[model samples]
Target: MRLISRLNPAEGVGDFWAYIRRPQPYRWPILGLSMLMTGTLLFWVLQERYYLPPERPQVTYITTFAPGRTDEEIIASNIANEARKDALAAEQAERDEIRREIYRTFGRAAGMDVEKIEREAAAERAREEAAEKARREALIGESIAEPAE
Candidate 1:
């Protein structure tokens, strides 16, 4: 019963409540010091680091046409030149892709027979050229036979 009374809340609850209600004098200073230390550490870390400046953007300008050229002509020439360059680049890329595809497709078997392949390709090209010539000749004959408009 004595050990139970020492452990019970109803027996010592008044003293416990009184101790909790008492004010502690060091609480404000401890809280203030902790806040000051945190602020100082944050300031030191932010100020000691090296920060790089933002990079400037690159700007490109095309060359102006010579004097006496109209605005429309200059614009048209610029558009045409750009189009031609783009088309040439596209064609070169397509040719490179075709060459790569052909090499990949035939690289295994073409190790020793590359010359034979070339010969066959040449013969095929010759046959196509002959057929085109015949077609052109037939067209010329038809034109010659037609009456004058």
Candidate 2:
């Protein structure tokens, strides 16, 4: 019973209310400082957890060259680099295709028109590309047009 009385939040709130009701010279300042501190802490936590952009993985390109390397060796190295890059691109394409297939399977399972969705996406891409091409041509024409003298 003693422990429960001591630990009761209502009693604690009553005591706090009595203390706050008493005359105090620094009460306003204390309240303001506490509010500011609380706001700063809340903002810091929210910014750290939600507002900050996620860090992306860095891409590092590695290349090797030496003064003593012959022309043939340099050419072979260039060819190997190109082949590796092409292989990576092909692997990425395969992964993308597999991912699309999985998405299509899920969409079909959910009774979605997967083919219609794909066609719409393709049409959207085409429209965007056309708009971009038109914008580029307009800019080029403006640049090439003779200025009014």
Cα-based lDDT for every prediction: 0.81, 0.91
The C-alpha stretches of model 1 lying farther than 4 A from their native spots are 1-90, 93-105, 108-112, 141-149
Tens digit of lDDT per residue, candidate 1, span 1-105? 898867887748887667656798886687699889999999988886668998998988675667689989989998999999999999999998799568756
Residue lDDT tens for model 2, 55-116: 89898876566768999998999999999999999999999999999999999999999999
Assess every candidate by TM-score: 0.30, 0.46
Leading candidate by lDDT = 2
Best candidate according to TM-score: 2
Residue 108 error, candidate 1, Å: 4.8
For model 1, where is the 10-residue window of minimal lDDT? 107-116
